[model samples]
Target chain A: MQRSPDDLTLSGDEQIAGEADRPFARSLPWLLLVGGLVGFAAAFTLTVEKIALLRDPDYVPTCSINPILSCGSVMRTPQAEVFGFPNPLIGVAAFAALAAIGAAMLAGARPRPWFWAGLQAGVTFGVVFVHWLIWQSLYVIGALCPYCMVVWVVTILLFWYVTLVNLGRTRAGRLLAEYHAVALTAWFLLIIGLITVRFWDYWSSLI
Target chain B: MAFKSPQNTTASGARAKIDAARAQDRRRAARKRNMTIVASLVAAFAVIVAVFLAVDPGSGPDGDTLAAGESRYVRSDSHRLTTAADGKVTLVEFLDFECEACRGMYPLVESLRKEYEGRVTFVVRYFPLPGHFNAERAARAVEAAAQQDKFEIMYQRMYQTQTEWGEKRTPADEYFRGLAQGLGMDMAAWQKAYEDPATLARVKKDVADGQALGVQGTPTFYLNGTLVQVQMQDDLKKAIDAALAG
Candidate 1:
């Protein structure tokens, strides 16, 4: 196995130590594949809905179940088209690329560092954009689209795992990698907490 | 083999080194396995707790199907035009101050407020329509006035003088600031609250609540959790009267 210069920085005696303790590293491609496909499906669904909305002005989307969960309301807003085109179009392309990359990686393709760096950048953008959308959905838009939420969850997981993989050469990174599941669980809990708190009235009334 | 040392010594030394490395690997793997098990158990326990709390089996809605929809009608912070001590009926109005339709309904709403008095709670919500040039600014001004115990005066002032600044392309912020001054509000404090992002957020919160209640236009009224269809001016009165009757 060809080791990079970063791998040599570890203790001399434990030359191959970091490589062996990487079961989490092995699961990266699986997360990418699954997350990417999930995100892709959501984005594609949103795109189709967007097209339908354009075709007929009064088209109520299938995902718009209630006022709080209304995609129809969100789709009509300018924020849905930040680039003068529907945001889901970007999602469709990016998620499709992610799925292809995951497939390549799963097929034992060892790409270069720059390639990983690029993927990291893409996911970083995706995660940041997803969070912005979350803020908009909860705060500004005052609504949530069910499909958009599916995309949010997958994007968060993909970003977390991709970041961990990119930094796996560092000691701190390896330590974090070991506690990956715990950290991920905590992150998800935090988001769930935010959603619960933000829509406390709506949620409480259901009981 | 290439070191040219005694073969047995070299072989034994290599074997010991391999054994030590394997032991370290086993220990590390075991620790990770244990940690993962503990973490998983904790996570599973948390999920179960959340599910239990969410279900709350015995205390669920009691067959009141409209409970969820009813919750959206009024929030604790919603402005009370009139509050009754034992009010069984709630009248929520999502309005844009600069909206002509809302202006048209203002007198009727005022009369209703007077007639209902202590029998119902008249709740006002800010829902500035995007098409209205000064609707949000007007709401912020009203909210800022509200902070100073002058909500009614400023609300009255907006409707009374809405024609002076309504539907112009230019922002009516200066006009609202002047109105704030005219209302005997402390200028420094009023200005501070007016410009505060939190004030805008507060107004937006109402707008958000309105949106969640499926309010797509100004002058939308909810009479006792039921959306009232106001085809004519009399419909609002009829709805309120019917709610009061029940």
Candidate 2:
């Protein structure tokens, strides 16, 4: 590892090049592969279920477990097809690409600057879109879709990791990398708290 | 082997001392970095949670009010559970008779209408979803009953016996006709009106009006012309009480 002379810290010990290829760092590619695959499968299933719903007006989706968690209720609304087509079409394409990229990373492909930038952009859009959906689900349309929630979780993790990788050698990014799990744990807790509080009545009844 | 010579041993000893010093330095740097990162991350997490809580929809009193058009929602011929001549608050409900959710809210609304009998004018507008088999015909039955001045009676009976006839996925016209006779309605007149375009038109008009008002589901409530976010009974009661107070 090469150290920059001007980048010396207060302790004056070499902080090194912060090269991300440490032996333990190899596990990140594997995590991405698994997360991407699960997300792709979920998005694909939601799209297929959407087609089934279109074919039959009375079709109750597999994800329609209850009133609170029904894809059927969500699908009938305009928000489900915001772009004049089902939103899952975008998901199916995006997640499939995400899974393919994850597989390439697992195969030891060191992506270039443009590749990392592309991943960052894709995930940034996904995070924003999912946040909007979370707001809509809790406030506007007033329902939750199970497959959509799966996509939301995976997308969040994917975005977080992608961002960490894109930050390169910055001090902030290095700090983030060292405590990646801590950041992820906080994010998960925040979202879970939001959902629990939003549907407190229904959730409390289950117990 | 090189250290076997005295000259090389001196060099090797100096190198060993330097390597030990570097190792100690690296360990200290690692400790410092790890601690700083953890502290920074915890602080970042706390700040994020605080900011989110400040703007969270869960904590905000952001009401989901519908922009109902300029027209007053209630038609002169619309169904009324309680008709108060000078009632200040009008609770408009867009409902489907066969919807299970409507059935669930039936007793609740019924009790409220009775409790606030003279204070509120409770109106029901037809909004029969295509999926429900008996919803449209039930609307017609209610309309047919309305012709004989027994709208309230038939409304109660239909809801009271909803489970017996609802969600059958088959026509329940004959059963509804039986209900009309039981309600002491003019059976012949009710039968003619059942097939009359005017009665069907009456029901369809209410549905069209509901659609115009942006009603997309059963049991959608418009209290005093604003959509009330029905999270709890207290929330709804508060809206009604506000409307009545005004």
Candidate 3:
């Protein structure tokens, strides 16, 4: 009655009940792989732009399309370097690690429960930090960076899935997981709707 | 070793049945939970839609209403930097050309114009302060430019070259005329318009209107006839956006 090394069932009771039958158990690896890679690329691009701006003070970022959607404005803000270093550096490291972990999981690495808990902690922190950044971009900074937005999307998706997977043992969590697609769509709609409404004037000018 | 004892085999079969029953019960529970979540989501969405339709913001009390007869926000003769097609949202800035703060705000306003281009109606009004020696002269110069369809050009030029002629005790009338020359305006017409008493009166009219509206400083902005207290550069843009949203 011994489980194999990679079985991620949280407890023996759930394992006995075959908790690994969930679809997320199979799909999450791929999600992490793709989400992590996309986030990594965005963060990497932002880091490059920040470095270029530092090298030449007059550098206009490629994402500086207009005043409202200007990366140049967002990058120049103190919040861009909240930890006394560029925030994208954290993104670069964290996303790369997530991608590596996803690759390992795809290769049948059933990490210890401690590892999953640690990852949950990391993603929770990422989600909170990203939301703070979103607020800063929308209200305080009054600008949006395209690459930063990409990171925001990936981070939110990753956080939701990871939390669902970790809380799989709970009945409410399982219920939420069943409606993940609906929940994700609603979540994204809320954010995108806010963006559209907040900058309606600037957006309408394009039309 | 194929040592299948009869009693042991029966116990394993019964355990298998129990496990299957537990799984089926779990799935039934999950299905009920799913239904509950979906039903609640639908109910929440319906409530949201109902609340949205119920709240008629136009009929609500507007805190930023202008007093009666304070139509000085935009006159027919007011110069527009950009006009919206719907004419729904108008942003008026009472600016003094020679004021240092107005010069500092120049780029921010220009960027806002670009961002809100056709979605906002941007109007300019002269509120030349008495402190600066060249304030009145600059307003008169710009007003004169308006006569020749060069109001926008002169308006831009004044801010672009504010440092050169601003804060000077002597008359920068010559400097403003130089800007007019740079713009290739007809010198005779420019001189006449610049010196016209009527042009000065036009500038004074705006100043008087701004005073009546409580515009005590340069770079005062009004979004849809309500004065905007802009403590930050983005406040002007934010106010216009809120008006447009409304």
Candidate maximizing lDDT: 3
Question: Which regions of candidate 3 fall more than 4 Å away from where they truly are?
Answer: A1-19, B1-246
Can you tell me which runs of candidate 1 are displaced by over 4 Å?
A1-23, B1-246
Scored by DockQ, the top model is 3
User: What are the chain A TM-scores of the candidates, in order?
Assistant: 0.88, 0.86, 0.90
- Looking at model 3 chain B, report the run of 10 residues with the lowest lDDT sum: B56-65
Best by TM-score: 1
Error of 3 at B208 (Å): 29
Give the candidate order by descending DockQ: 3, 2, 1
Position B36, candidate 2: lDDT: 76
Task: Please write out the lDDT profile of model 1 over residues A113-158, one tens digit for every residue.
Answer: 6787899999999999999998887887677789999989999999
| Local lDDT at B208 for model 2 | 67
Cα distance off (Å), candidate 1, residue B225 = 16
In candidate 1, what are the lDDT values of residues B1-246, reduced to their tens digit? 122334587776776677667756854986687678658866786786578656643222111233333355776667899997787889999999999989999999999899889988999999999898789889999999999999999999999999999989777878999999998899888987775545766787677667877898989999888889999879988887787788
TM-score of chain B of each: 0.72, 0.69, 0.71
lDDT of 2 by residue, B1-246 (tens): 111234577776786677667756864776676677667767776676566545542321111221233243776566778876685688989888888888888888887888888888898888889899889889889888888888888888888889999989767878999999888888999987775544655676677677777888988999877887777767767888888887
Cα lDDT of model 3 by residue, A1-207, tens digit: 322222234445545344356536667888899999999999999999999999976577999875566787789889999999999999999999999988998998776668888999999999999999998888776678999999999999999999898776466776677677668767876777677656644444333
* Pairs that collide, model 1: none
